[model samples]
Target: MTAPMISFEFFPPKTAEGLAKLRETRKQLALLNPKFFSVTFGAGGSTRDRTLETVLEIQSEGHEAAPHISGVSSSGEEIQGLLETYRNKGINRLVVLRGDLPSGEVSAGDFHYANELVSFIRQTTGDWFHIEVAAYPEFHPEARSPSADLMHFKNKIDAGANTAITQYFYNPDAYFRFMDQCQSAGINVPIVPGVMPIYNITQLARFSDVCGADIPRWLRLRLQDYGDDLASLRAFGLDVVTELCQKLLAGGAPGLHFYTLNQAGIISTIASHLNLQGD
Candidate 1:
């Protein structure tokens, strides 16, 4: 069997200790030979500098680093400047996103949606970078309907996105259905499945709620049974993610993108389980 391709997602650190942890996480996971890795941008462009810094650091360590860019937070000039900076650093991949509105405020129109950003990037960069866009297996929360959401998704690809990384999900069927819909819509780009291993049930629940990802009752019940036992929780979490991956591959997913949560152990375990260890 062909080895399953993998990538990871990380966030910029907020403190000195957090920065140390981020570096350690990168070092440990880099040994797994991920196809690429991404550093998330903060809401309202709060972590713009740090996001670039982290992306460059990952490249410096000889790994592919794809920085996330929020079109809703950046102007055309700002977006060009960021692209130029990454080009100067020899980084040529980006995960373009239509970021959520800032807390307690409305959008001020830097960008209204990701398709607009995709068009802007293509017009500015002209294939200078490999661009990836976000997909919603359960449909975007802001979308009017699933069909409308998918139409918008297809629009992004037409605008010049080369690949799509889905929102993290537990249900493999959701992903398969999404793939089928994309195929029917004529969006032929790779739709990489985003996998999130539940490190903490409460934390996962909160994130799932915000991101519109459903947490199945079976998994929730298992977490509730494990209660506060970290060791058991982690073991079960690994098993769950492993099974999810297996099902995804069995259903024909091209690759897996892990939300590493700035930690190495869970991702490393999953990679090993998939037999994707580095040389």
Candidate 2:
């Protein structure tokens, strides 16, 4: 089998020091030859300008940069303006989603769902961008049901998404099953597995809880047992995540899209373990 491709996700940094660190991180990870580096938008489009700035920096550094465009607090006209700016900047890819709203914020100010956002981008841009949408292998936390959740995914495809990046998951079976379901539903698009390398036990647990990404009872219990032993925790987590990556790649995953959280150490180590270090 051919080697699986890789990509990475990063959030916009808030400080000059953070930007400097991200530049170093990008320099190191660039050696792995990721297909692109995606910069995430803030919930309710709070970091719209920051996301654009980061993507521009990545592009200026000669890397493919895809910006995440959220719909929660944006209008169709507003998104069109952003798309126009990206097109002018020669950006050709985007991650589109119905991002969340903060407490007391309007649920859907100008766009309520991702499908609407996808449709609007298509109508506005006319194939100028390769759109990437989100998928949930274990099902979205707020989804009504599995089948219903799938319909929501299908809606994005119908609205003109080019591919999908699943929410980060550890269970390879869930991913395979999701692929099977997508096949059965006649939704054929590259659905890359989003891989989140485990580093901080407490942080990981909190994120998983909020996103509804399951941590399986066994792994959960084991991580809890480590207490404050970060070295041992990271070691064990690395082994587990690397094994998971091996299984997914062997099973025909198109690629691995890592949620790097703007750091490089764990991701670099994982890539090395997967023999994806460099040419």
Candidate 3:
């Protein structure tokens, strides 16, 4: 079998110190030779400038950069301008999303959904970008039903997204079942599994709650038992996540997209454990 493609996601840091640390982290991850390094757009386009700056710098470092763009709080003119800027800067990849609504925001601006954003990009930039949209193996939290969530995902794929990256999920069964559903629905685009290397149960619980990813009851209890013993927790988390990746790949996942949380230690270890080094 061919080696699976791998990618890493990062958020733009707000502080000078944080940015410096992220730069170092990227340097370490770069050795893994990911397909690209993606920088996230904050909720409602909050980190627009920082994201742009970070991606441009990554490009300068000679690595492919995929900057994310969220459509919920942005206007057509604004989105158009950003696309033009990235095209000019030679950034040819993007992760599109229906961004979180800014606290107390009433309108969804020009594009209300991620499918709209994908469609807009195609209209404005044609085939200039390789677009990736969000997918939810466990169903989106706000989705009214499973069928509705599948319909929404199909809409994004139909709107011109080249591929998708799923929300981080611990259960490989959930991913395989979602893939089966996508196949039945005739959605053929590559849908990469997102992996989150867990280090802290509390933080993982908070994220899982918001994103609708299920942490199996047994796994949660085991993690909780680790309590303040970070060393034991991390070791166990590493084993769990590494096994998860193995199962997904063995089951024919297209690739893996890691939610690195801007730290290299655990991610690096996981990649090594998976033998994800480039050929």
The candidate that wins on lDDT is 3
Residue 74 in candidate 3 has what lDDT? 93
Off by over 4 Å in 1: 277-279
Q: Against the correct fold, how does model 3 do in TM-score?
A: 0.98
- Scored by lDDT, model 2 comes in at 0.92
Over the stretch 33-81, how does candidate 2's per-residue lDDT look in tens digits? 8899999998888899999999999999998999999899787788889
lDDT value, residue 112 of candidate 1: 82
Candidate 3 residue spans exceeding 4 A from truth: none
The order of the candidates by TM-score, greatest first, is: 3, 2, 1
lDDT of 2 at 89: 97
What would the per-residue lDDT of candidate 1 be over residues 113-175, giving only the tens digit for each residue? 898988998898799889999999988877899999999999999999999999998889999
User: Which run of 10 residues does model 1 get worst, by summed lDDT?
Assistant: 270-279
Q: Model 1 misses residue 159 by how many Å?
A: 0.5
Clashing pairs in 1: none
Determine the backbone clash count of candidate 1. 0
lDDT of 3 by residue, 188-259 (tens): 999999999997999999999989999999999999999999999999999999999999999999789999
RMSD of each: 1.4, 1.3, 0.9
